[model samples]
Target chain A: MTGDVIASRDNPRIKRLRRLAHEGGAYRREGQVWVEGDHLCAAALAQGHRPEAVIVTPAGMHWVERWRREGGLAADVPVWTVTDAVMGHISPLESPPSVACLLPLAEGTSVRPDVPTVVLDRLQDPGNVGSILRSAAAFGFAQVIALRATAALWSPKVLRAGMGAHFGLHLVEGADAAAVEALRVPLIATSSHQGAWLHTARLPWPCAWLFGHEGQGVDLRWMARATTTVRIIQPGGQESLNVAAAAAICLHASAVSAFGGL
Target chain B: MTGDVIASRDNPRIKRLRRLAHEGGAYRREGQVWVEGDHLCAAALAQGHRPEAVIVTPAGMHWVERWRREGGLAADVPVWTVTDAVMGHISPLESPPSVACLLPLAEGTSVRPDVPTVVLDRLQDPGNVGSILRSAAAFGFAQVIALRATAALWSPKVLRAGMGAHFGLHLVEGADAAAVEALRVPLIATSSHQGAWLHTARLPWPCAWLFGHEGQGVDLRWMARATTTVRIIQPGGQESLNVAAAAAICLHASAVSAFGGL
Candidate 1:
């Protein structure tokens, strides 16, 4: 633990943190990504991922010390004490959390097609992806497969939105319709206007759920291959549901159909 | 109609348009708001609101003129032609649409709580509020009332997330629990871990649906006042549902229970 403080905003490490927070490729280049706040950090440690460096201000250092005393952090991890300005320079949030860390990406797990899954087709919004991931974790969907154009499941916005769900699921991005087609499980596709009304259908348990883009529904190729199409019956006077909201309803319904009351 | 060319970025009209697009307070200060893309402009016009200014690129002007020739925009409305930079500057979207407009906020109608309604409590994210609004509109919830701390319904992020649902339903922001109490209808509050199973319960239709903060559920005072507490039965192994997702399920379930099959 370097007690030497980084007071200058121009410090090379601070510059790297700024780039990592704001841009996509910085993390890949550095072989690490920055995670903000205590909860995410705790979640990472819980998942057995070790932090490379913990950067904090003096007051934040005290908070980190408390975290260590409380058994929230690994005793052996290195902590870097930095000035408040340096901490702010590295934080993605408007108000910096007590700590931020450089952690390696969670390694990809081998994906099995037969497991109940949630497939994202070019779901471009990071927040939507994150919310869907949270729903997937909540409903016990075994995996999340994002089409090539979908937002990165581990991107900063998605990570923030997912809360800690990213640490709990099998997330595979840059996938295609072929991947979904290969799954042996029944595939359920959602639409604003189509297929079976979700509530009335004999929804099968442990089935794959397919959600699509904000403006566009499931991709045409996947739609063609989908065994059945389901629509959440909207009795209201409006048009369609947000894809993420729809995913939550569909996932919850599937979970209940599979396992009973929540 | 003056055919004055506005090529310079420093033009007052252009600067004002940029400000209106970027600043949250711009609309309130100027008594005007910007609507970009054909869909939103069409939605506004359909609601009988006229725009103060219409800025379009040369190509956009040509396309709009063709549409007008084919009986698109109302004939009496004035449309201003502009350069691409001006059009881009006034647009909130990353890829600016061909047309952009500064329109007055439409006068809101009185809240009619006779039908299904959705109430938001201290929802701070503009995107979530917008998505919830879209869900409320789709599920036949007649009105959406946002707590004073809820993101402003008319904020740019919300306006975009909501698509055109803002025009389709009655939206009132800065509301309180008293407003929910005043509905004179049964308030169905959504809970993650308590209450009767949503499906089996004799849920009320056309009822008032209540959702709380992103991190917290409904305020305890509001929860205690709720006529019924209901939860979506999830069988899988997750802690809680995202607030927006929870709202969609509850609202849809209410619609189903009251109206019969979705």
Candidate 2:
């Protein structure tokens, strides 16, 4: 089906797109997220999702055209081709991408207690949180429990940083202490100081790793509750690594210890 | 000594600071970089660096006052108090930080051929470059060689993401292929595909790890020159990991292999 040409910025769909693109939390209210670029949109389709609607600029029409030719999109899904002005008005990026799709936010769900998990405790930076989610998925951590005050899991910045990893993992946002406590797996906390060295530690498999705020570490309560804590030895005497870097190292170590060298 | 209060943003020193804050390569032109926040300032001092001058807003005066009282900063290093308006005008941050220091950029230096090093092959993002620097320091990599197209090492964004890692590492920027090949140690390239698994590789000590662009893998010329190529095992079957995350994982693996668990 041919996409409808939307020339005016005042179009209702364009206004809605603007909100979802600029306001990170607008998705929560509208129950839909705007996924831009082909990599993300394709990832969504690979996961068997049908976009509620598609928005394309002239630059993005080629991808939509190809997908339609390939019968990759359903006939019922609306595709709107907007003018550059309309796209620029709706886009948060300086150089707005050519195409984007609106995907419904998955319904709220409880944490899966048995899988390998990473708990984000009040991580404020969307980039850091999204990178952690990407690392978590790569290293076999299946779930992410983001505590209250953490950057919203589905925010545009987070989604962009995640690079489509969001489509692959189970994420629980705005989780409280009780939700974390309910996990059956051991809670392992990572600290830059005061723990058994990561490579030397006897890491448990199928555990949940708790990484805390960018500056402050895991909450003291979580630290006290942890079954074990691991420290990544900083041989150069730097005080700490970036939180996402720390998570990648720690998660990789756990994956190696449990499943042997990748 | 009491600080001179500069109330106007048009002051010459304030103008210089605004340039450094807003332009990533302004440091190269000005021969100095602006270090912001108490954490970064303290990190510099801890490394025995004395700022050429200090700029403080009212919000930042208390620390400067405490430092002067404690005899931490030198008598000759001028501290200028600026109005909040002046600070806001110079600062790129939404809520401008209370204080920043001007440090002279060190003269260009060549890489130490035999030390563990990281070769950034045109990675574009300042955050990625800075995060890799932080990881390099944490994992015992003593030197970082950023290729010609990579983000500048002393850029404000990189400095912020580095979180003081720049002070501890030997950084050589704008390097070419000749500079990279001059290193005496092995060139170890990391790829998401077509390499020995990282965990099982016989990781050589004091090797130079090549991490490439965010969108592309290492330039094929460099890839073919690598003594050994290693890939991180991604059990989740994800196509690729973020460049910085990959760097942290690869560098940490090398550190662990070279030095027994810390």
Cα deviation at B190, candidate 2, in Å, is 0.4
Query: lDDT per residue, candidate 2, B109-180, as tens digits?
Result: 887889999999999988889899999988899999988898899998999999999988888988988888
DockQ of 2: 0.73
* A185 Cα displacement, candidate 1 (Å): 2.3
Candidate 1 CAPRI grade? medium
What CA root-mean-square deviation does each model show from the true structure?
2.8, 1.9
As a whole number from 0 to 100, the lDDT of residue B132 in candidate 1 is 89
Worst 10 residues of 1 chain B by lDDT: B106-115
Tens-digit lDDT track for model 1 on A133-169? 8889888887898888888777778888888887777
Report, for candidate 2, the interface RMSD.
1.3
Predicted model with the maximum TM-score? 2
Q: What is candidate 1's fraction of native contacts?
A: 0.77
